[model samples]
Target: MRVAILAVQGAFIEHRKKLESLGAECIELRKKEDLEQPFDGLILPGGESTVQGKLLRELEMYDSLKEKIESGMPVLATCAGLILLAEHLSNDEHVYFGTLPVTVRRNAYGRQLGSFHTDAEVKGIGEVPMTFIRAPYIETADEQVQVLAHVDDRIVAVQYGAQIGLSFHPELDADSRIHEKFLGLIADCIKNNNCRKN
Candidate 1:
């Protein structure tokens, strides 16, 4: 399977390494033309949500990428990527894609010093390593959203349809379970003919 990593800004290279290690052909999406490439799934890596959002629009990649996500493209969104997908931001006014039906609080865990790591139960995945840096936890989710994992009683992970949004940076961890789960989602979408083609 082939996957597209939003490389406009963020820790996208880490995601590429993880997915490529899983035997998936990976492409970096740094420009609007990159969207023309055929891919089974998309990965939005951890980074500054504001900067990424701005770059997406400036590069004219915002609408196309958002349309893909809304149209059932399997997406694995980490950290700021999760923020981009959220429908509501409790602490911030700007909303990016707003494809995931959940509310998130930007930098809910404080600043860089607040960043930490741990192993937690990620629903179907079981205990997996999670690293958070200026993470944003889910404040509330729509009824259809599946609660996946939590840390310190805060909602840190959730799934809605083909989209999986996480507050922690699974790419930073050695464990490949999360990325594997994302790839599995892509496979399922392809099998069901729900995944979009180029």
Candidate 2:
């Protein structure tokens, strides 16, 4: 299985390493042309949402990527990725992809000092390591969104359709369950021949 990681900025390298460790062909998506390669899934890693958003449009990859996500492509969006996929940002005026039906509060945990680590239970994946760094939590999930995990009474993980948004950095830790679960989604897509063509 092949997976693409948004490499415009942030901790994308960690995600690539995690996905590769699971035996998936990992590709760094830095430009529009990278989308030409067929991928079973996409990982939008944790990063500065504003920067990634700016780079996506500057590189002319925003619309196409959004279209793919909206087209039922299985995606694992983490941290800033959660913000990117959210339909609304409670405190911010900008919306990136806005494909997932969730409202996010950017840096809701606070600034850099707000960063911390903890173990949380994901609905389908059980308890796992969650590393949050200036992360944003889902303030409100729409009717169609499934609340997967919570920390300190805040929504930290959610699954909407084939896409999953996480507030913590699963790739930054030793646990592979989260990525494995996402990979399972990709395998299902492949098994059902639902993967979109490049």
Candidate 3:
């Protein structure tokens, strides 16, 4: 399977390395031209949501990427990526993709010093390592969205259809289960012929 990692900004390289280790072809989506290639899934890594959103539009890749995602392309969005996909933000007025019916609170865990790591049982995936660095957590989700995992009563992971949004960075860990689970999602799409373009 091939996956496109948005490298415009943030911790994208780590995701690429993880996906690569799982035997998936990884592509970096940096410019609009990079979208020309066929990819089975997309990964929106952790980063500053506002900056990523601005760059996506300014680089003219926002519309096309949004279109693909809306067309049922499976996505694994982490940290700020969760912010990007949310339809609502608890503190911000701007919404990026607005594809997932979730409401997230940016920096809900305080600043960088608040960063932490822990092992949590992700529904359907068991316990896995989760690293949060100035991350945002989901405050509320539509009825259709499934809550995957939580920490200290705070929602940290959620799945809505073909998209999975996590408030923690899974790529920074040694475990590949999270990334593997994502590939399984893509594999399912392929088997069911539900993949968008590839």
All candidates: CA RMSD in angstroms? 1.0, 1.0, 1.1
Kindly indicate the candidate among 1 and 2 with the higher lDDT. Answer: 1
lDDT of 2 by residue, 1-198 (tens): 999999999999999888889999998999999989988899999989999999999999999889889888899999999999999999999999999999999999766548899998899889999999998999999888999999989999999889999999999899999999999999998899887747
Q: Model 1 Cα displacement at 80 (Å)? A: 0.4
Pairs clashing within candidate 1: none
lDDT of 1 by residue, 1-198 (tens): 999999989899999988999999999999989999999999999999999999999999999998899899999999999999999999999999999999999999886547998888999989998899988999999999999998989899999999999999999989999999999999999999999866
Residue pairs whose backbone atoms clash in candidate 2: none
Distance from true location, Cα of 66 in model 2, Å: 0.6
Please provide, for model 3 over 1-198, each residue's C-alpha lDDT reduced to its tens digit, 9 standing for 90 to 100: 899999999999999999998899999999999999999999999999999999999999999989989999999999989999999999999999999999999989886547999999999989999999998999999999999999999999999999999999999999999898899999999999988973
TM-score of each: 0.98, 0.97, 0.98
Question: Looking at candidate 2, what is the lDDT of residue 158?
Answer: 94
lDDT of each: 0.93, 0.92, 0.94
* RMSD after Cα superposition, model 3: 1.1
